[model samples]
Target chain A: MTGFTTTESLAAYMPEQNIDTDAIYPARYLLLMEREGLGPYLFHDRRFHGDGTPKEGFILDLEPFSKAQVLVAGAGFGCGSSREQAVWALTGFGVRCVIAPSFGEIFAGNALKNGLLTIALPEEVVARIGAAAQRGARFRIDLEECILCVDNEIVATIDLPEGQRMALLNGWDETDVLLQEEGDAISGFETRHRMAQPWLFQGST
Target chain B: MGRTLYDKLWDSHVIRSYDDGSALLYVDRHLLHEVSTPQSFIAIEKKGRSVRRPDANLAVPDHVVSTTNRHLPIADPLARAQTQRLVENVARHKIPFIPLDDQRQGIVHVIGPEQGFTLPGITLACGDSHTSTHGAFGCLAFGIGASECGIVMATQAIRQQRTKTMRVNLVGLQSPFINAKDIALAFIARIGANGAAGHAVEYAGPVVAKMSMAERMTLCNMSIEAGARVGLIAPDDQTFDYLRGRPMAPKGEMFEHALTYWRTLPSDADAQFHRELTLDVSDVEPHVTWGTSPEDAAPIGARVPSPEDLTEATRRERRRRALAYMDLKPGDPLEAIAIDVVFIGSCTNSRIEDLRAAAAVVAGRHVAAHVKAIVVPGSGLVREQAEREGLAQTFLDAGFEWREPGCSMCVGMNGDRLEPGQRCASTSNRNFEGRQGVGGRTHLMSPAMAAAAAVTGRLTDVRKLMGGKP
Candidate 1:
C-alpha cells in the first residue's frame, strides 16, 4: 500500500444514495482471485452493456471524469456486502479518495487498508463538494492538514481519528502495528480471559 | 449510569485503548468462508505469520460451492479454485473446517449458532457483512475486511473505534403475519438505510423478547442492511434453550458456570443509549422491498412510492433510479406485481423454522406453473431435519426444487442464478441490483411470503394464504 499525503484530482459525483458494494462490484465476479485489473468490472451492469461496451452517460465512462481519481459520492456509499473487491475495483480504476456523508462500517475499514482515503463529512458539506464535482471541479484532499480544498480555498475540514490519520500518512501495516504495540497486552488479556471462562476453551475443535 | 449490553461486551474484550480512541479487541471466535479467506491467508504467509489461535477459528466453503451434486467436482474453474484455496489454507493453518460434504456445512452465520460456536458476551468476527447474525446470541459480533481478517488470524486482535449504542425497542404485540423478516424490513424502512450508521443496535422490549432464536438471528442478520455493524438481542432463556445441547457448547458443570455469566449479559434497566427508538409491532405489516435498497420497503399491500414525493433531489433521484431498475412505477400495487421465481433460503431465513414456515404455506399447494421456486436449506443438518419432518417432501410436492444446503440463489455465486430481467421473491437479506444475477430483480420478503409468491405467481400477502392465521 502507498502512503497517502495529499492528492489533487478531478472528482466524479454519484447522486444516488446507498450505493451498495454489490452494485459497485457484482456478486458474479466474487470468485476472481486476482485483485488487480478489476477496473473493467467496476459497476459492470451499470457502466457497461452485456456486449462489454461502455455505457454512455455514466460518470466514470465519460471523458474527464473517466480519468477522475476522486469520487464525491452520495450518503451511505458502499453500504452492502463486506467484499473488499469493491475497494479494489475503485482503486484499480484509479480512484484515490472518496468523500461521502457516511459509509458502510466494513467498507470504510476496508478502504483504509487498501490506501483508499474515505472522508466522512456532514451531509451539507458533502453536498457542496458534490455540487462542485458535477461542474468538473478539481479538489485537493490534504491529509496532513486534514482539510478539503477546491481552487486553493478550504471547503471542508476532514476529521479522521489520529490513529487512522497516522496509518494513512505512513502506510502502516495494521497487523504489524497492533502486534508491535499490543502484543503483550493481548497475551495478558487472553490468559485472564481463559481463566475466567474455561468453557470457551473446552475441546470445541 | 447503567451499562448497555454493547458496553459490557466491549469492556470485556478490550486489550488496550489507544489515545486515538481506537481499542485493540481480542476476538474469541473467527468464522471464515471461502470467498474472503484466500487473500488473508496469502497476506499472512507473506508476512511469515501463523494463526495465533487456531482453535478460535473455523472455516467453511459456502459462497462459491455448487449447491447441487456436492459429490461431483465444481464445474466453474474460478469458483472451484476459490473453494480449493480455502481447503488448502485451512489445512495449512490447522483451522477447524466443515467441508462441503459435512452435515454441519452451511451458511457461516446459520451454523455458527447451530454448533454453539456463538456464545453470549464473547466477541465473534467473520469476513461477511452478515456476521451480525451471531449477535443474536448476544455476542459483540461484526464483519471485517480481508486485511482485518489477516490481523485477527495473526494476532487474534482487531483495532476498533467504539460505536455509540442505539436501542431499538419493539414495544407492542406482533401480529401473527409479521415475522422477524417483516420487523427487519419495517425497521430498515422506518430508519433509512444508514439509520444505525456507526452505532451498535440492541434490540429490546416485548417483541424481541418473545421472538425465537431463529427469528432473532433473522432480524439481526439484516442489521447490516440498516448500516449497523453490530446488532444484538441480549441473551435470554430462548438463547440458553437453543444452545443447551449444541455440539460445541459447554457440558455439565461447565455449562452451569457459563450460564451464570450468560445470565448477566442483558442490559440493565437504566442502561443508556446514544440513540433510542420505540417501534410498535402491532402496527407493522408484512413488508417487501419494491426498490433496490432495503429502505425502499413498504407493506405488501402498499403501492410503489413516487419519487416526486421525496423533496430532496438526491433522495428523489435515488427513488427514480431504483424504480427504473426495478421496472416499477408510482402507484403500482406491490401485491399485484408478478414474480418469475421464488427463493426460500439464505443465512437470514434458511433455518428449520423458516423452512417449516414456507412448508406450512406450501403444503398441499402447487407452485404457480410459470414460476420456478426452490428451497435451499441453510445447512445439511437443517436439510436432514426438514426431510425428517417432511418439509422437504412438502416443498417437492409443491413443485419447488429441493436443493442442497448452500447460499444458493441469494448470492448466485455457485451458478444458481436467475436469467436476465427475471423477477424473484427472495428471503435473502439483500435486494441490491444484480445481487442474485446480473439483471435479476429481487423483492426481499419472508420465506413464507416467498412461498406465497410461488403459489400465486405474484407478491401476495401470506396472511391471506395462511387463512388469516399466519
Candidate 2:
C-alpha cells in the first residue's frame, strides 16, 4: 500500500438516488481472483456499451472525472444492496472521499471500515460539491481536520465518531476491537459461559 | 438502564464495552453470499484468523450467477469466479454452504427461512439488506456491513448499538382480497420512511394473526424502509408449525423444547413499548408509491400528494425533489399513472403465494402491448412450485416473461433493468429513485396490483382486474 494519501478530488458523478453496490461493481466481477484489478471494471457493465465501446455520454467517462480521486454525489447515493464491494470499487477507483447528501445505512459502514471517507452534506451542499468538481476547484479534504477545502475555502465540516476516525486513519479492521481488550474477553467469556449458562456450549456431535 | 431493543439485544451479547461505545454482539447466525465472503476470507487469510463459528454460519451464491440450468456455465466470468472463491472458502473454512445446483440454493434470505435456519428469538445478520425479512419469525435480523461480517466470522461476535422498540398494531381483518403487502405499504404511508428510525418494529393485532407466513414475511421484510434495523412478529403456533419438520429444525425432544422456548419469546401482554402505532385493517387498501422513497406511498384510492399539502419542511423538500425525478404531477390520480413495466419478484414479495395472487389477476387477460411485465421467483423451490401450479404458463400466456431469480430487477443487480425514464409497478420493497436501475422510476405495490398494471399498462385497481378472473 502507498504510504501517502493522494490529495486529488474524484468527480464521482451518478444519476440521483439509490446508486447500488451492484452498479459499483457488478456481481459478475465477484469471480475475479483478486480485488487488485476491480477498479477499472467499476461500473463497467453500465459505462461500457454492449460491444465494449465506452459510453461516451456516461458521467464517469468524462475527463477529470475519469481521474477523480474524490466523488460528490446525490441523495441516497449508496442504497439498496449491502454489498461492501461498492466500497472497495469506489476506493479502488481512486476515490478517497465520497460526498453525498445521504448514504445507504450499511454502505456508509462499509466505507468507514475500508479507509474511505463518506461525508453527508445537505442537498444544497452536495450540489455545491459537484459544482466545485465541474469548475475544477481544488477540493481538499482533511480527514483528521473534518474540513472540506474547496478552492482554498472551507466549504464544509464533517464529523465522524472518534474511534472510527482513528480506525480509518490506521486502516484497522475488526480484530482491532479484540486487540484493544488485551486478552481479557476470552477468559471472561469462558467463565460466564461455564458458570451461568453451561448449556450454551453443552452440545456435542 | 435504557431498555431499547438495542439495549436488550446488546446486553445479552456484550462481553464488555470499552471506553468507546462498541461491544461484541454474540451473533447467533451469520449468512454470507459469494460476493462479500471472498474478500473477507482473503482478509482472514492475510490475518491468519480461523473462522470461530463455522457451525453457526452459512454461505450461498445467489447474486451474479444466472439461475438458469445449474450445469450450464455462467455467462459472466466474474460471477463464476466469485462463486468459485466462495465454494473454495467454504470448503477451506469447513462452513456449511448451499452451492448452485444444490436443492437449498436460493437467495440467502429465502433459503434461510425455508430451511428453518432463521429461527425465532435469535439474532440474525447477513450481508444483505433484506436480512430484515428473517424478522418474520420473531427474530431480530438486519444487514451487517462486510467488516462486521468478517468480525462475526472470526469471533462469532460483532460490536453493536440497538434500536428502540416499536409496535405496529394491525387491528381487524382485511377483506378477502387484501394482503400483507397492502398492510405493509399502509404502514409506510402512515409512518413515513424514517418513522421507525433506530427502532425495532413488531407487527401484531388480528390482521397480523390472519396473515399467512409468506404474507407476514413480506410485512417484516420492508421494515428497513421505515429505517428500522429489525422488524419482528411474535412467535406463535403459526411460527412453530412452520418450523416443525423442516430440514434444519431441531429434532424430536429438541423440537418440543425449542417450540416451548420460542412460544415464550413473544412480547408479554404486560410488556411496555417505547413507541406504538395502530393501523385498522379496514383502512388499508391495495397500495403503491407514487414518488421516490417507500414513504411516498398511498392507498389505491388516494391521489398523488401536491407539494403544498406537504407542509413539513423535510417532506415539502422531499416532495418537490420527488416530483422532479419521477415526473409526476400533483393531484394526479396514483391510479391513473401509466406504467411501462410490471416486475414481480424480490425477497420481499416473490414467494409462491405472491405468484398465485399475481397469476389470478393476469390469467385471462393479456398484458397491454405497451407494458413489459416479468415475474421472477425468489428461489428455485418457488419457481418449481409456480410451474407445478401452471402459474408460470399463466404469466407467459398473459405475455409476461417468466425469468430466473436472484433478486432480479429488484435492485437491477444483473442485466435485467428498467430502461431510463421507464415507470414501473413493482412488487419489491423500496421505491427510492434508481432502486431498480439507473433513471428507472418505481411505484411499489402488491403483486396483484403489479399484475393489474401488467394487464392495463397502468396503475389500475387489482380488484377491478379481478372482476372476470377466477
TM-score of chain B taken alone, candidate 1: 0.99
Q: For residues A1-205, what per-residue lDDT tens digits would candidate 1 score against the true structure? A: 7889999988999967899999899988888877789988888889888778877799998878999989988889999899999999999999999999899989999999988999998888888888898888889999999999976789988899998888899998988887888889999998899999988777543
TM-score of chain A of 2: 0.85
Best by TM-score: 1
**Candidates in order, interface RMSD in Å:** 1.3, 4.2
Segments in model 1 whose C-alpha atoms lie over 4 Å from true places = none
CA RMSD of each candidate after superposition: 1.2, 4.7
Tens-digit per-residue lDDT, B1-470, candidate 2: 32433334445566766455655566678899876677678777888888876877878877666745557877666667677888899999898888788756778888888887887766789988888899888777888766677777787666655446888888976875677888887888787565675578988888888788899899889987776768888878888888888777676777776676666676766677889888888867788888877777887877888889855554577678788889988888887898999999888888999999999988888999999998989888888889999999999999998877677677765567788799999998877656677678999998988998999988988887777321
